[model samples]
Target: MDAYSGYNQIFMHPEDQAHTSFITDRGLYCYKVMPFGLKNAGATYQRLVNHLFAPLIGNTMEVYVDDMLVKSRTADQHIPNLSAMFTILKQYKMRLNPTKCAFGVASGKFLGFMISQRGIEANPEKIQAILDMTIPKTVKDIQSLTGRVAALTRFISKATDRCAPFFKALKGTKRNITWTAECETAFSELKEYMGRAPLLSTPEHGDILVVYLSVSASAVSSVLIRSKDNAEHPVHYVSKALQDAEVRYPDIEKLAFSLVVSARRLRPYFQAHTIHVLTNQPLRQVLQKPETSGRLVKWAIELGEFDIHYKPRPVMRGQAVADFLSEFTESQASAATQHITEPNPPLSQDQTPTKNTLDLTQPLWTLFVDGSSNAQGCGAGLVLVSPDKVALEYALRFNFQASNNEAEYEALLAGLRLAKEMDARQIQIFRDSQLVVHQVNQDFTAKDASMTAYLQHTRHLLATFHAHTIKQVPRSENSHADALARLASALEQGMGRHIHIEFLAQPSTQAPLICTIDHSPTWMDPILQFLQNQTLPANPAEARRVRHRSARYLIINGSLYKRGFSLPYLRCLTPEEGHYVLREIHEGICDPASKRLAPRQPRLLPCRRKTHFRGARHLLKLSAAKPNLQDTCRHHNGLHKVPHWNFVQSSHFHFPINKEQYLGKTKNHSPTFTVTLPELLLVTDLGIGERSAGTTPVSEA
Candidate 1:
């Protein structure tokens, strides 16, 4: 019975080893001592014990290695249960450790948790370890100690904000490490609170409600428990210090994090009961629908795992005491259970406008649009702007067969094209289709070839305007467009035609086309005009082909492509134009190569001499002196007389070779000198004649 070493086998007594034939016998007569450190020791022990007492103990008694707990409700049944377990131990020759046994106790501690007949509580020894800690001298020391105690703080109340001031004082350049009155108070209060922590009732037998609250830098959470008898109690409180990055999140995001963390921390309790989350913020508004922002949407998705309803502040305070009770309350424990559950009110129409309104004062014009398709035809809708905000436009382009996304894309394209026609210098387009907006913005890649082509065309259309921007607005904010899209779909379905058109004019003398719908040859002009003005392809054949294809889409499925414009509609050009367009596309796709080829090359040339120099006065003097000496020697030794040596004069004159000699070199050889065979034969033949005894006649040739 060591705690770390589990029980699976019994050691033979030294006196009994001689009588045991476990070593020699290989049959059933021998009882082998099981190995203690085997991988299956724990499992084997549990299996063996369970099998041995299956008839007597059944499910009443459970043993895990050396630790055992026997659960029974009444004392009358304990003696028999104890006796049955003792008989098994004796039969197996297993000895029990006297000091490690506990019997007939109403509550017992095991597996790092305390369990009782009525409830569960934190181990006092674990809490005492936190209380005995000395004051920290450094930030690291304080954080380490606090982190260890924070694990047990879930059993205390107001753990986050209550301890914030103490944690804050640990920062700064002051090294004196003085504990302020607030820090000392918080520290001592935490220990005292844990010492008197209440036992939490089992969630299986109670109705649980969790209240989660969050600030910019911290999140606080608490759980309330109430039995069917209406006796309510505070089970435990938990909190966590948010990272610096988390503290900078928007108010909605912070509130979302608070609820998400609380739900996860209390999953065991909340999972067993229908839990209600009461918060000071309007979390219901966020949870009522999906979010477009990935971070918020992901957090919202995490919140969906628990069966909990979000109660807003205004509604929560009246129906539930979340705020006051969350802090410090001495009211009767039953007060929390007195409030009646109120059903959520039906949504009012007046709230719809407030929910969808955008901030129009911002520099960019925000345009919202949506599209839908049904059995009748595909329809697209767009709402450019309203007095206070941008209204979602609902345009129904009938006689088009496409998917929901295709319709959405057509609607978006129409809105963008209309914005461009309005001379909107700066545009901020909003839509609930995250896929469409993200794809167009190049934030995500197009997974399909058709989508890739359509996205490319859509981006080209967007680039025609100055300062064009696209963003994903929440579905709630894009309601106007959603409504228009639904209406268009309804119109198409009711009409049962290939083409349908409608226009909502602005409230002015001009009555400009705020919206348009058409399905006829006559409507083609306006559609063509819209495309042309938007710099969309304008070839009639191409347009007719596009219109026909788009019409076919409507006829087949009553669905238009997402962002509405078809690939052919955006690309109305002949084969030649298409070739050029393809070339341009290729160039754009290969821009990296073009960038590398743009720099100029450095200049290089062969080296050459600029000028040639003539003979100097010093060279002329040396030539004159050498000739004078040669003439004096010739006059004395009777050699040839020296001619006039005009060395200085000759140096100033330029010489030219004779024309015959200069041009003497013909195609093969120069005529300056010729060698005869007789001259060479004389030298070679003289040696041969001198060595011969007989005289030989030399032949002349």
Candidate 2:
């Protein structure tokens, strides 16, 4: 009869019990009944069958519950052994679940584990149940669904923890019964993962496969299946929410749980195969060394069963992808396209009407240019438009080692050169780099030498035009020129000049830069104040070193380092160093009026020497009376409590006295005191005193 083991209990219905009793009363031999749902029912059943089949166990067959396996070196022996088991079951009036039972079938599943003539196989149907499950709408639904598949939870690494957010939302106290965006995202991802859960291959035919198991604080186990083909697949994915106590385990310990589960579950697969295990940790390294700690030694011994190969997370991704693909079938190919949807329809003409009517009222040409540079190379390009609404494109590539600023300057130069060639005087230059435009307009000075040279060249070129204006345009608005720049750079292979030429009608002026130079004292005061407040270091050694560095940077400023010492130079120093140098510079360079206003002393903390003692004994002792000494005194109290008087009295004492005291005997001393002190004579004892004494001594004859 079909029986499912439930916890430690064996249970049988009244009908089955009556059938078994009737058969026994009829004098027919029957195997003892261990009902399903009884505590230890499976174990008790197996033990009973083990005894009944003991004589035939190794000879030809073995039975576990309703399932029987007949194994022999020869097929001849296997057939008869199988028949004998069936005959015994018939005599016991017990029936096997035909659907659940298998005989002489090369492969079958029994007791939640797959069995084959070759070896045991991991059940993939269990993983399919998780994958095929619908998105759990409510927490109760999710729990109820997950509960039904709890036996298979071990196969799902880190089962509960990965689903914790979903679980938390289900609690009676939790609000927002609807799943959150995060919960939905996690839910969808889990469903996708379940859908892609792989079928673990049988570990027979000597083919090797490795199982990588990992765990996190929130999750219990993550199992990655890898075949010797070096292709990783998911044998079964399992994870559980860590219990309160498990969460306290250190990261490595928590992670080791996956390995523990995988090792136990996949034990049958590993016994006959040599598999290289992959783990998302250095468990292998920890295991290789002799375990120094009891816990580590225990973990190591558990992991020692398999050959392990540790892989970092980055390296594990490739294997994980392979495992991901193992679940794919021909039918699921169409599902991959769900991520990419059809394109939007074209907009109606009225939605975006053309505004290309030419404006001949003011005849002017506008040029938009852009530039870019990286360590590899630099490029510049420009799109010129005529008053007739036509666009002219030009781009150039420079092979020199230049910064983005220089590339921009060159792009401006190229546009200016193009405008001059086109003989378009009173032209407007539009550029994405604000720095380049400002520097060209003389509103900002060119900071770099290369840019300065380009700026000079640009000014000289601009001089050719009767009237010219440069305006900064945002990068987004300068895409036409940007594309040309990238194209120009891509066309040129090496360090050489390359150019592109195209044509277009320019659009009307979008924005304009109005240049107004006023000789107002408002602007000069800040500049003058900044220069007057500059300072240099007082230490000649430090000053000289800074001066040498400044000399290299100051050549462009056109003055010696000492004369040109300014705030800009000090800006390069770190905050603390910059403050100190600025203070020194202000003290030395500032006018007397400014000098008086500066802080008299530099605002910096004084340096203090720290004393460190090597051992605890070298620390200072503290009295109980001092508040500052409380910690030390409190500890000392334990060490220096009052000694027990009884113990002190039991201990022996040693004391020393001077010889003169014993020898000084008074004339008034009584006979009692003399007798107590021992007899003292004028003649000295040789051993006790000097050799002049004629008295016998203890050491002398």
User: Which candidate ranks first by lDDT, i.e. highest?
Assistant: 1
Please give each candidate's TM-score. Answer: 0.42, 0.35
Q: Lowest-scoring 10 consecutive residues by lDDT in candidate 2?
A: 502-511
The global Cα lDDT (0 to 1) of model 1 is: 0.53
Predicted candidate 1, C-alpha RMSD? 30.7
Provide the RMSD of all predictions against the true structure, rounded to 1 decimal. 30.7, 30.0
Error of model 1, residue 385, in angstroms: 4.0
Error of 1 at 545 (Å): 48
Q: Model 1 segments beyond 4 Å from truth?
A: 1-4, 7-66, 80-96, 112-114, 126-148, 169-178, 205-216, 299-305, 311-383, 386-701
* Candidate models: Cα lDDT each: 0.53, 0.52
Please, what are the lDDT tens digits per residue for candidate 2 over residues 249-360?
A: 6555555665666567667655545555554345544432222234544655555444444544435444344432222124323442332222213234333211223233
Q: How close is candidate 2 to the true structure, as a TM-score?
A: 0.35
TM-score of 1: 0.42
